[model samples]
Target: MESMMSFASDLKSVSPLTSGCALIGGVVVLLFIKKVAISAYKTFLRPAIDFTKLGKWAVVTGATDGIGKAYAFELAKRGVNVVIISRTESKLEAVKKEIDDKKYGVEVKYVVCDYGKFDTKARDMIAKELEGLEIGVLINNVGASYRYPRYFHELPKEEIQHLLTMNVDSTVWMTEMVLKGMVERKKGAIVNLSSAAARYTQPLLAEYGACKSFIEKFSCSLNAEYSGKGITCQCQAPFFVATKLAKMRKSWSVPTPEEYCAQGIKWIGYPDDIVSPFWIHATAGWVLLTIPQALTTAHFTQVLGGLRKRGIAKDANGGVSPQKTKKN
Candidate 1:
């Protein structure tokens, strides 16, 4: 009778612990399921907003070669006229010609104002060029990053200036210029290009990542402030797309600009203020969020450190360095 009583008491004590663990596990599973379902719905089920209904024209910055160019083409295909801006007038002209040749039934124009300058003069010129137009969408896609990962101290004065002005200043100024018009019209969409660097800690690419983070936050706040007025502001955070800036080959994770923009276009004007539109990138982003920040930061430190070593070695050997990421 004594042994039986002791066993019963132990069983009773263990039951609560077991039940508690089970409840915790059940909650975790439920949360995971909810996240998966939401992701699936956004990626496959949500209908894409027809951006043309917002206005007749979309302005895309850095629209010569990479994701910006792809966005310009995509908007044109959707029956919206495009205005492409870039530092290189020649490249901009070429892109305009290519779009025109496609006969997408939308006018294409080019602006040769360098966001690197990011000055009042440049802004005035752009303002003059865009006067008397119903500008609906603004793709704040112009940004700069280091050619390869390097310590902040070693970054040149010019490079630092470019990073701040091109990435941060340009987005702020461009939005300021067009925001009033959109507010008056009471309908517009703005897509600001951020990067995976912003979402996670980046060691060697510190300034670049910080600039992108600023963009993400700025975009979200803009969305909050303007959505009630019929304007939607979004930050599109991409991981890696094969482009001159990224210097990576296309793959499942590193998509071509076309592949990225194809999915990315759907998210614009949607309720989400910040999104990694590509499904794989979105999944990776979620995983990063689940992991410890220390782990991610250390991983970036090691990887970028290795890259810095190789870049320095190539320079010493008189080999061609990776091209500087002038625009993205």
Candidate 2:
């Protein structure tokens, strides 16, 4: 009976200890779960793109029209002075005037230079114009694809060369020019305009897509390298934007340039792998990564190519009809 009593006492004494251990375990598990939940919320539920923190001057190439123009307007709205670059002096003047009249408390400057051909004189001219100004943001937005719908081989060599110069070479040179200053200052942001076609292999825009892919990869890698130095770089790969360029295409999803640019600029300060409205599409590549690559590529090509052919694409002048291309 004494032994029995002793055993009961021992069990009773250990019961509290066991209970305490269980409680501690439960609390530890709960804390771990809470941490995981927070991480997940920040990773998935939060907005992927954000640029509300930027408050410096921004330079946008091809800023007179389409997404570029929208970027300029959005940046100005965010209290950033703008340096607009493009070939058309009249268009640049008009855009500058509008921005000035809007009284956004931001300065707007214009640089009229063609990117189709690399001219040392033109580069020097642009450098001189930007010599004294401090540019906090550099947007490599100027690009070109084949205007008329044609097979890769069907396009003229000159046209292809021009496209390469504008889309790839010019972007590289401009980035080099600005990045030097950015690296020296240890502060800057660069946003390059890539395309959804960069990921998918298409029949018509083979070179154009390839060039964009280069931009996307280059910007991402560069971002990784410079992020430690207070510099951020992003390559945006949006689907068809309503622009004069999109009008020449037969079909595209065709978001307004304003909508695209708004989202893009918003993403400049946001943390994410890439910034693209196309991600919201149910059938987009990012959503369907588990599917076969060949099938995804085919679908993208057909849908986007069809849109280009239909002339339903958007442009800088807004959503005008196909016949009204020259009017803008």
Candidate 3:
């Protein structure tokens, strides 16, 4: 009987520790289940919010090609009047004609302003064109990235200036132009095109990644500040979309611009501040989070270093970079 009592006391001694561990495990399982449920619902069940409710006119910057062009087409197809802005007048006219041919029954306007200029004159020109339009949605899609990854010191001063002006300045100034009207109207959706690079400490692509990170942070903060006013500010962080900027071909992992924009437009006016609109991209993003940060950084460094070497070799061979060969 004395021996049995001793055994019972030992069991009681470790019971609290076991109970604590089990409680923690249970909580973790519950959290995981909740996250999965939410993702499933967002991916499959939630109806796309009606963008027409926000306003009559939607403006897309960098609308001459790639993702911006795709967004313009998608919005017009959905019966929204679209103002497509880009640096080149010829390409804008071409896109406008294409939209007209589709006969989506929506007006398509074009604004010619080089976001790279980022000057008061450029701003005034855009402002003048946008005036008197009930601007509902603004897609801040205009941005610049490196032709090829390079060490920070090796990048040209001119390239750095262009990056700052095109990516950062344009987003801020364009938002300033439209946000007041949005606030007064009490309904708007601003979609800023960020990149998955923003999620990493990209080694050779440092400045480009940093600029995208700024967009992500800016969108999140703006959403927090104005969501109560019925304005949805969102930053889309897509990975490897097949576009002129990426110089990548379409695949299951890398979607075509049309495929991406189709999935992308569904996300507007939702509450999430930063999103990977495509479900595959979202899954890839989540998988990336599970990898150790050090590993991910080292992997990016190695991959980008290889690209830098190839780029330099191409330059030595008197070849133009793909980025320079085609306008993004």
Candidate 4:
């Protein structure tokens, strides 16, 4: 019995030592992971554009209302000449007139083009319009979600095509076109507006979220590729920005348009860190690190679906609901 007690005590002592080593090892691993995450955040999340380093002109697409118009106004306030591109020339003209009336000492120009229905001619036209202009900043802010919330098969074929064209094709084409001049000069800032929907599992907005996911991933990869050079490519993904589009989504928490624009410009002009004001919503990077990409993608699809349903049902009146207006 005495020998048995001695062996039991020895086993207990050995078990504690083993547990202690394991605890220490776990802590070290966590610290290493934290270090890696911080390094990545600094490397990719940082903004590349320095407004003070900006040249003569800036181009803003979809610069008629909401977030795009706000970006134009902010740039104008900084005395940078702006070229506004949108489908509605009248709206562009109105914006120009307002800027001129403000006497902000910035020139405003407009290009009437629908990015959703892009063609070779439209691309050439934009290229011609941009010729000889030193464009220091390019804001790819034109994107659209479906008019009605539905599953993939339930959505109209035309609407799907339109969304894909506007959200993915036009954005990629515009970046590619503008990048020619920027790469030649080796100095330019490209700001692509992405979305938090990219991270969440949203079933109803599967395509929209997927497109945003593409933008986020593409921007990060592009930044890695071009950071060695002078050009900086930054993607700004905000949550529930208080734009005309968000206004239609009754359940969304709309951050003020002015605030969104300010944050976006700050990121575009001087991205040395993540530009998102609502960093709490940065689940994409976290999930990508913690879980498998496929799993995270699946989760985001489901989350987005719920959001889409809420967005559609909450504001079915076609007018800005009281809840949305109040939130804005």
Candidate 5:
């Protein structure tokens, strides 16, 4: 009887260290549950902002094709005119025609300047185009990445310059052009396209990811500063969007540009600074947030490295490598 009692006592004992870990785990789970509940409410039940009331026109950089174009179309359907900006003149004209001819019945205009080489002159040109427009929205969708996935050092000086100018400089400049109008009117919305890479550490695509991360941080601060002024600034982050930049065909996990933009447009004018518009991605995000940061980073590194290798081999004869990215 004595021996059996001693064995039972040993079975019931738990180390103090184990007890502390269990307590911490319980706290983390509760926090995660709260976040998910809030997210579900915002995503499913929260009403969207009525954009037609914001202004007469919405401006989208990189609006010739892909997500940018789709976003432009989405807004037009909601009765906002579109100002399209892209590098290629022919593509610009084509987009304008598509919108006009298809009877989107909204005014479509273009300002052609390569975001890759954007400078003071380019900024001035875009600002001039924006003048006198009842601008309600600005979509900073232009972005740059390596011809393929390249490490930070592996990227050339010129390529880095282009990436910075397109991704960072163009966004700030366009925002500067439109922000005053919004401030004066006390009504507007700004959507800056960011990437899930900002949330997920991508190893080989360091600079691109960093630039996207900068956009998210930058948009968040701006929203906080301007929300009281009647402006909604959003930084949208998505994973595996099917675009030319991504170079991957669409799947259930990867949405087409049109599909992605539909969700994105619905999310406009929401109070949230950072929003994952896709329901599937949002659900997956909840699970990922529960994971340990160190483990996720390690896993992302391996996955992105494999993607880089595959991209390099596919583009081996194309002079430039393929960059895994969303609508650029």
Candidate 6:
């Protein structure tokens, strides 16, 4: 009886509102813990796809830095040779050299191709270069966004054209170029990097988000059509990671490219066509998607509008952002 009384006294029963608030808080904490635990297990413990078993060669676009570069090295470590493509020859060569020196013990080759402007001859060259390779994996990681988000109508004509071609057309054509080889071989994995922004409306980034959404839908259908033939198409939709293209620095919210790519590589052959491979990214996505669409869009647009203002000021300082003189 004394023990019972002591326990009851310690409880110090509170008002119903206080108890209700405490209960809710506890539930939220538990849910967050569960999500974190599950995501950590998936990121660190899951067995990565045996990429070498699929083929000898892996090709990555936009491989000079960030996620693309990280994936190229990850594949090389798995004893697969890599072919990297990017617009800057110097940057590509530097990545290739880094792969070589890191002693991945796999061949590292690079192709220089710019996605901002479509070039028939360059496309043919890429195809020709890949013609004889026993390609196993294709990482369609090249992508672009607005220099800063703005209303769709406010975007410059050149910027619109660039984003459409770079973000959408490049993925389509590159996949077409590589997919036939995979189908014929009857064994391959293709990882197409999309954006989490696609899952919800991004008012200031309408076209960019739309293109990513298209990539997700396209990857799912493509996988269904070809999975029976031993091809796996994965469309990964990451929320954000610090990269030059994103114009952001690495943070807890924005994982470094290496960390993101490591988790991403582990998710190859993952059952879902769409994925947020990083732990924090997946958790943030779940939370954001639960909010009302109107609320989310309103908040996002305001944030992006600020970025647009800053971008405009910077470009003005830099003398109109150096428009390319080349037609290509």
For TM-score, the strongest prediction is 3
- Please write out the lDDT profile of model 3 over residues 1-328, one tens digit for every residue: 9999999898788878797999999999999999989987877778777778889999999998999999999999988899999989999999999999999999999988988888999899899999989989999999989989999999999999999898999999999999999999999999999999999889999999999999999999999999999999999999999999999999999999999998888888898999998899999999999999999999999999999998997787579656665664
Candidate 3 clashing pairs? Answer: none
Error of 5 at 38 (Å): 3.7
Model 4 residue runs over 4 Å out of place are 1-52, 248-253, 269-275, 279-328
Question: Where does candidate 2 stray beyond 4 Å?
Answer: 1-55, 248-253, 271-273, 277-283, 300-328
Per-residue accuracy of model 2 over 152-185 as CA lDDT, tens digit each: 7767789889988888887787887888777777
Tens digits of per-residue lDDT, candidate 1, 1-328, equal: 9999999888788877798999999999999999899989988788778878888899999999899999999999899999999999889888999999999999998999889898999999998999888999999998988878999998889998999999999999999988889999999999999999999889999999999999999999999999899999999999999999998999879999999999999898886999999999999998899899999999999989999988886677576544543232
* Model 5 stretches astray by more than 4 angstroms: 1-34, 311-328
Model 3 alpha-carbon miss at residue 102, Å: 1.4
Indicate the worst ten consecutive residues by lDDT in candidate 6: 319-328
Clashing residue pairs for model 5: 147-321, 148-321, 148-322
Output the better candidate (4/6) by lDDT.
Answer: 6
TM-score, one value per model: 0.91, 0.74, 0.93, 0.75, 0.85, 0.84
lDDT measured at residue 94 in model 4 versus the true structure, 0 to 100? 97
Using TM-score as the yardstick, the better of models 3 and 4 is 3
Report every candidate's CA lDDT. Answer: 0.92, 0.76, 0.93, 0.76, 0.86, 0.87
User: Residue 267 error for model 3, in Å?
Assistant: 0.8
Predicted candidate 6 versus true structure: per-residue lDDT over 1-328, tens digit per residue: 9999988886777777898999999999999899779778777798897888889899999999889999998999989999999999999988998999989789998998998875688789899989899999999999998878788888889989898888888888899998998889898888898999899888888999999999999999998988899998999999888888886788888988998988899988655678898878887888887899899988988898887887776677674433332233
Worst 10 residues of 4 by lDDT: 272-281
